[model samples]
Target: MLSLYRAGYSPWHRLAAGPKALLLIVIVLGVSLLPVSWPGPAVAAAIAVGCYAVPGIGLRELRRQLVAVRWAIGVTAAGQLVFLGPGPAAANTTRVGAALVISALLALTTPVGALLDALERGLKPLDHLGVDRQRVALLLIVTITMLPVLARLAHDVREAQRARGAPPGLRHFAMPFLVVALKHADALGDALTARGVR
Candidate 1:
């Protein structure tokens, strides 16, 4: 799930990050502002499919994204079912599913450095307000990069606990995971200090 980028000579891959980001924002807003009706969701789903048809988005990548969101899709459907009945529930679920796909598509197609560069460029206007665009871009990059690392660390900690015959609950793994995470933070802090980064 973390290594979502796929190298290819597709049009999407060649597109500038600024334009891509703008298009992504437009698509997301269009989908979100749609009326919560059958046709709206259906159209949204079709748009998502069209996005898949764009170059670089292959069946394998699509399938991986779908599989990754299966749980969220199921839970969303179930919740909407209870509150909105079948028709609206389907519409809402489809909208959410399309959004997830679109997000994954963007992440898979764009390089992190490109995204950061784009963000810095886009946010440059805010510099007058004392907003540091470069700093903001760096923070965003660190956040995206850290999420998968933390997830992997948690998975590894859980596996290690299981191997040691520990119980299945999070309680058994929490302390060790916290300790390791703190050690990771310390090392990162030390590195930053040595590099004269505030």
Candidate 2:
């Protein structure tokens, strides 16, 4: 789903991924530091929405992505409203929500491979410091790819366990998940080695 979203032919899709990721970080930090004002968050949300207006980007698909993160937005909003007082506290919550939505839009429109390449290029200077830039880049790529895969695997495992009458508990889930994850990691490592990535 994520890859599909990133595969569009929008202008944002044409932009280099590395710069887009940096822009995302900057936007988040800038919005967070700005005083709790309605305009800033509103503008951020508008920009995120406008990004969807770029040609070849389906609004429905963007809506789906927003829906997927609805729970997170709800949690943040609820926590802020419950823990903090009202007024500016609630505004902060909205600001965070806007930032998350904007970030998602950026990711949705940017290709992962391009982004990874950009990251690798940006971190090139670290190689002089003996940081093993390629290894770090590979690790980052693996980590990013594994996140969604792991989520799907966990969901499937939970459903399968429930079907087999196993109790839904961490004790029953953790070991199997870890074992499966390790197997995947080993397989990925083998593939990487075969491709002379290390």
Candidate 3:
């Protein structure tokens, strides 16, 4: 479930994580701040296409990442349709989809450990403000690691219910997935405690 990173000797892989992450953040913020119907989506689309051209990544990975955010895109589009209009809705959806692709590209190229270490180092300067950089980094790492696991768990639960002749419904899977997630969280906490992380 945590197999987003693709190890390779490509230029993207050779780049340092700190600069890559900083650039991504800056770009995301810059695009997000633009007018909804401006050229933001067009520029983002171009960059996303460039991301897809990176070695070790293909259409399959791109499809998987886009599919993962389909629901969000649909909901956002629907909301904007009702409140704003079709043009703005389309532009906003495009922008959001482009952001998702860019983020997926980052995850696909960068190792999780490197990202976490970069985050910790980035946060070190804020130590005087009562922030625990290590703890924050750990939390971010855990959150990122759990995302795909949770998605897989939900998918498995749905499949299991379907195989058992139950209707394909989230209601049937919600409680079970919650229990499983809680158990996983407890195990994670115990493991961290044993490792003297706190």
Candidate 4:
């Protein structure tokens, strides 16, 4: 479920992990910091969608990223719509979409080992402060991989509800999701501890 790397012969796949990760952060931040107007964020998102045309990435990867983040996009849009009005919601929604696409693009192009190595190298400055760079890097990578799993869990829970003829609402959804999420957290914690992480 956490496999994000696709073997490819493209330049993106060949690029060193440090630069690739940095570019991912820069592009996402640049999109987010754009003026809180429709065209800015929307256009950024459109360009992000267009990134699928790059040599290694394809329509299939794009759709997977969309599927993985669909519920999140929906919830973010709805929350903003109810609280902040359509303008902000529209901007934030597109921004979120663009960011996810870009992040997923990194995962699709770069291998997990490459990313973890890059993260450890980048965090070396903190080693002098008693930071365990390997553990920290692994933690960061796990977080990146976990996002899609969480989204998938939400989708499965929703589908299960529909299959069982349960009502479609958060009230009915929250408890089950919470329980499963907690169990997930507990398992992750146990795994980390077993690996000698404090």
Most TM-score-accurate candidate: 3
Q: Report the Cα lDDT for candidate 4.
A: 0.83
Q: After superposition, how far is residue 5 of candidate 4 from its true place, in Å?
A: 1.8
Residue 7 displacement (Å), model 2: 1.7
Instruction: Return whichever of 1 and 2 wins on lDDT.
Output: 1
Q: Please list all clashing residue pairs in model 3, or write none if there are none.
A: none
Order by TM-score, highest first? 3, 4, 1, 2
lDDT of 4 at 63: 85
What TM-score, computed on C-alpha atoms, does each candidate reach? 0.73, 0.68, 0.81, 0.78
Per-residue alpha-carbon lDDT of model 1 for 94-167, expressed as tens digits? 88888877766656778877887998998899999998788787677666556444555676787798789888
lDDT of candidate 2? 0.69
* lDDT, each prediction: 0.76, 0.69, 0.75, 0.83
Name the better of 3 and 4 by TM-score. 3
lDDT of 3 by residue, 29-132 (tens): 76676677668667777766776776767667777777777777898899989998989888888888777666666676888878888999989898999998
Off by over 4 Å in 3: 1-3, 144-149, 159-166
In order, what is each prediction's RMSD in angstroms? Answer: 4.2, 4.4, 2.8, 3.2
